[model samples]
Target: MTTAKDLLIIAIEVDPSGPVGQGDLSLALAGAELIDLLGTRAVTLTGDRVLPAGDAVPEDRLLAEAVASLDREAPYETVDDWLWRRGRDLFAAYTAVLEEDGQLTRERRRRMSFAAPRTTVAESAARRRALHRWAADEPVILALAAAVGIESEQTEEEAVVTNDAVTTVLAAVHDAVMELEAVRRRRSFENAAFANVWRGA
Candidate 1:
């Protein structure tokens, strides 16, 4: 079963322009893993929010710890809230695993005196093939695409869409775009719902 961490790594490698900073990349990766685990029934999601399922944690150390955290929550957390804050640890942990697996190598670079680790893809063809297959099969893209498209059509088909209704549409479109971007930074990640706003290519 592919975790979000794996998908993030693959996305980074596949994108020609790599991540700009470690912080953004790590959190984004963590969010991806959270979503993946949820879809696998390892956790639960209600709308965009995530709640831990009362089930045994998986054997995968990374996912197990994440699930445990969610399950142990006082009053469960939204997946974005949890991952955006704590994903750095998960990203670091998974990169070490990839380094050991010989698919990537890490090198440290100093950016304004702070050390930033750079990841180089070592096994390109194999990894790309795997990512491609995952992209084709993953449900996230479809969900996001539909959401963005529907929201845009609604807004455009009616010139006088209510302020409250427009706000709701924007929120849904933003959530979908954010998740889709985290998964695959490809051209297809865009939809007309965000035409007025800038979405990084």
Candidate 2:
């Protein structure tokens, strides 16, 4: 399975204290795709900029589309730029693909009697592979998971991710997630103040 798919499965199957932000998850998924591309030598990073290495198509359909979307011009897309652009609604896209591929199944959320059923990652080979990778403390996948607030078996310093390109993408993902959180906080404060004014506080 592709890194993107594996990451998505982990996000769904793991029981975090709270739901992962769709935006943060999407950005990480985009970063995962870039890391996978680097693994295949389909693309490489010159500093933070993405440069296509060849015309080779990726085996996964989503990854193949990612290759097609690369910027081939001078001053190629920065890793940060690619994250936000390609990551737009990326979680939803991956969800659709997994569902269509039968990697996702639905079950009743037992705790909430009024709650609608939710789609959960199925018991499949893809899921087992992802969980095994998670258990093995794979640095790239763990780093991506951590960026979205999922705790890993090993801390960042202990994991010791060696590849510079993967490190670059993971750093970009962390920064983007931070920026998105800051925006959320700012909006929340603004709305709170607006509510106070409306209530003549």
Candidate 3:
């Protein structure tokens, strides 16, 4: 009995688009194996990989990092004012990605609006919370085989190929999520320290 990880290694070792679609099939199988490993409901393997859900970090820290990052790029002296401006920008970018990917229709996008009262501490906190939730829950990879209408039960070789592709996507998505969380944590720490300095003054 070959393990999912073992199958993944094999799939990764071979090129997907060789003389045949062996590589592609292997990749798909890898994804299926990963889905089994990661717990299906926790993540949905939509396109090339599973969509990640759950809070990656605390709400306050997530917001502070976003504000700090935006302020560093632009110029904002106060957190209250900065939250209002950056919140809109962040919402726009988030919606744009969702729309472009067909995750949300035009009507849906129009109907949905981010309402954060301007210059209020509550508004800033809410905006940060929403952004953190989005960042944490967004799907990292879209599984390819299912998107193309490939069935799981095919041949031994085909199953192997599909598993390989999926595993590759899973590994990449996992790594990316880890990196994002790490960066978010670092930014949160920096923002906390900066906020303390502001308080001291």
Candidate 4:
């Protein structure tokens, strides 16, 4: 299973309503895709920039699309740029693909007629593989998960990923998530201030 798929499955199975909101999770998933591409040598990291290292397309549709979207020119794309550009609504994209592949199922909302149906990870070999990898505390996956605020039993120091490229991508993901959170907080405060002004408080 691809690391992106495994990471998505683990996220859904663990706690869909937890600290890792869609935005944070999406950024991490984008990082996960890059990590997988690095694994296949489809791309490489030159410092913090992503350099396309191969012309072969990945077998996975999303991954192939990712490879196709690379900036092939000089200076290439920075990992930070790729994360934001590629990660826009990426969680929805991955969920739709998983549902199409029968790795995820959407449960009908019985009472809340206006609410979106709840999606759950289906019982499949894919899920089993993800769980196994999570159980083993694989450094890359663990680090990706931690980026989204999903804490594993493994401590921070113990979850060190050896590959420098992977480590760079993971750090980028964490920074992106933190930046997104900061944006969220700033907007929230602004909205609250606006509401208070309107209320003459």
TM-score for each model: 0.55, 0.94, 0.27, 0.96
Which candidate number maximizes TM-score? Answer: 4
Better of 2 and 4 by lDDT: 4
- lDDT per residue for candidate 3 within 63-169, as digits (tens), equals 32432343222222232232233333333343343334443343222345674321111123333443342233322112332221232233324323245434555
Off by over 4 Å in 3: 1-103, 106-162
Pick by lDDT: which candidate is best? 4
- Cα lDDT, all candidates: 0.53, 0.91, 0.35, 0.92
Show model 2 residue runs off by greater than 4 Å. Answer: 109-114
The stretch of ten residues in a row with the least summed lDDT in candidate 1 is 144-153
lDDT for position 119 in model 4: 80
Task: Note the clash tally of each candidate.
Answer: 1, 0, 32, 0
Give the alpha carbon lDDT tens digit for every residue of 108-196 in model 1.
78667575676776766547754664456433422222332311122333333233322332344446446756665554445544663
Q: Write the per-residue lDDT of candidate 4 for residues 78-100, one digit (tens) a residue.
A: 99999999999999999889999
Instruction: Give the candidate order by descending lDDT.
Output: 4, 2, 1, 3
Q: Tell me the deviation in Å of residue 51 in model 4.
A: 0.7
